[model samples]
Target: MSKLVLSELTLSHFRSHKRATVALDGRPIAIFGPNGAGKTNLLEAVSLLSPGRGMRRAGADDLTRRPEALGWKITAILGSLHQTHELETWAEAGNPRQLRIDGKAAPQVALGRIARILWLVPSMDRLWIEGAEGRRRFLDRATLSFEPTHADAVLSYEKAMRERNRLLKDMVRDPHWYSAIEAQMAEAGATIQRNRQDTIVQLMAAQNAAPTAFPTANLTLTSPDPIPDDLQMALADNRGRDMAAGRTLIGPHRADLDAVFAEKGTLARDCSTGEQKALLISLILANGRALARDFGAPPILLLDEVAAHLDATRRAALYDEIDALGAQAFMSGTGPELFSELDDRAQYIEVTETDRESVVMQRTSL
Candidate 1:
């Protein structure tokens, strides 16, 4: 079985927490607290364990605890296979962030090989109806879970595209300048497209195979400009028009994800509101299963206000599925009753703001 457990969590000047340490047992964790009690901050800190930004994508300054705070630090003990690994992420007074593994400095991407984190925030409630950016980000997060190197490909592709756009706007007709950049973009673009395609394939397979309460999503990669199999040819074909428009218009950058209710054959946006939320949850679970099969472990999951959106039956089913998968899922909500179905198979924590400081306590053992 694959498992990632948190034995200890320490926070200093993190959000509303001035200083705190919470010991955890081996089980899924459920956090309950009122609004603005800094419940989500705890999850955000855990999400930082993986690559890219945290769940909220807040800036460094935004994470610092309220008045009189300098910076924040989080230390976690990740356990697996009778072994333990210590990880820490911190930002100093008005300084850039830093990550430490076993007391040694490491790159952000390196964290992926050691730990994988995935999340579903309350803001995502509008995912289907909102713009494509959130959905695209959601897809990329799933992409990164299976293939950590997808991060580098994304970075490389975006950098080259930026330079290509600059050249276009400058009216630099010299093929020499644009050629090298376009070549870089083409190489990375092909890799990006392939990774996304492979991830979707894995998700679809998992959705078909999974037996759960959530509804399956028929997922596809959509694009206004068709992504040609031949990268060089595609780039060459779009060069003139791209130069005129001041941007490369025919690459992975313009791609969007299309999702539908597999059973009803209704588009995600057209589905009922409740059905849309179910589809999103189904896709996230499918992403986790796919990663588990491909990487030998499921990514750590963060579900913010998850219980609020899910009915009792679906909530019980989700809990059962997550327990069976042996995934370490951290779920947040307003009350402990939402997690009642977990019974003795989960951990419970209470988050609240008190006496000008934030607190996270292991209130009960599930």
Candidate 2:
């Protein structure tokens, strides 16, 4: 099978790194650094190689290095299925970011076709207990990994919903404006729902087929009320109530993802903190395995501070699974000992901040 790897990466004026570059082999990468040394910043840069606002969802303005605040750029040579593409994503003075593939300007969504990326960050440890928005985003990211076009569907649905909400806020009762916007919302919303459902099925199948230490999670795509079979009709019917509420009430935007520990039958939110993390890891691995089966390669995974949460046994198991799957998983921690088990199996990079500038040094071994 072909492998997906970032053979080379360069960062300039991005976050804490003024200028840094790293060469990679087709193996998982273990990055260790001190607090505030900009380790997660590196992962965030890699996350941008895909789509969306990256792992932090921060605007371009927030990504630029301070003092200089001169904008930032990330360039990479992406290897996928025996093919190579030059990818560049950047922003100028906090403007919206742009993408270039092989020297040609392209929309952000275009990167989705060639680069499949998924991530688990420190903040996501609270995902199960947080509001539905976070869970929905997690599901959508998985869906996007499976179907790149899912980005387009989400964008369409959100755009239409935004317009509809405006009309609601303005108390515009004209049926003409409502008909077109609602129709667009219904079309895109339906696509969004279908993609999410399909991804859940794929994840479930992958979880059942794999034999791993991580616990399995039973997932369901749900909403407060039954989604109308004909979304257009639902929108038309909800118009009165929506205007009163000043928002679009019923659509894919309001959807939620519910998960339970398959073995324990306890809601993920109610699971022990460690159990919750395990469930998330299980789902992420399952998502990767499923993609590898369907796409000839697994998506690049960004796991920030993941090692800190796992016990020695589970940490060793996690490394074994990552190696077995042959995924280019990028992990970060505060010290090399956190990734001791992965010593020779993964590449090591040490990051340090000196004089307020971050430096990335590739080490051959611990």
Q: Please name the candidate that would achieve the greatest lDDT relative to the true structure.
A: 2
- The TM-score, computed over Cα atoms with residue i paired to residue i, of candidate 2 is 0.98
In order, the Cα lDDT scores of the candidates are: 0.85, 0.93
Scored by Cα lDDT, where does model 2 land? 0.93
Q: Cα RMSD (Å) between model 1 and the true structure?
A: 1.5
lDDT value, residue 110 of candidate 2: 83
**Tens-place lDDT digits, model 2, residues 1-366:** 788999999999999999999999979999999999999999999999988999999999999998999999999999998899999999999588999999999988888888788899989999999999999999999999999999899999899999999999999998888998899999999999999999999999999998999999999999987788799989998999999999988989999999999898999999999999999999999999999998888889999999866998999999999999999999999989989999799999999999999999999999
In angstroms, the error of model 2 at 291 is: 0.8
Error of 1 at 53 (Å): 1.2
Please identify model 1 stretches exceeding 4 Å from their true place. Answer: none
| Candidate 1 local lDDT, 137-205, one digit each (tens) | 888888998889998999999998898889889988878887788789889989999999998999999
Question: Would you list the clashing residue pairs of candidate 2?
Answer: none
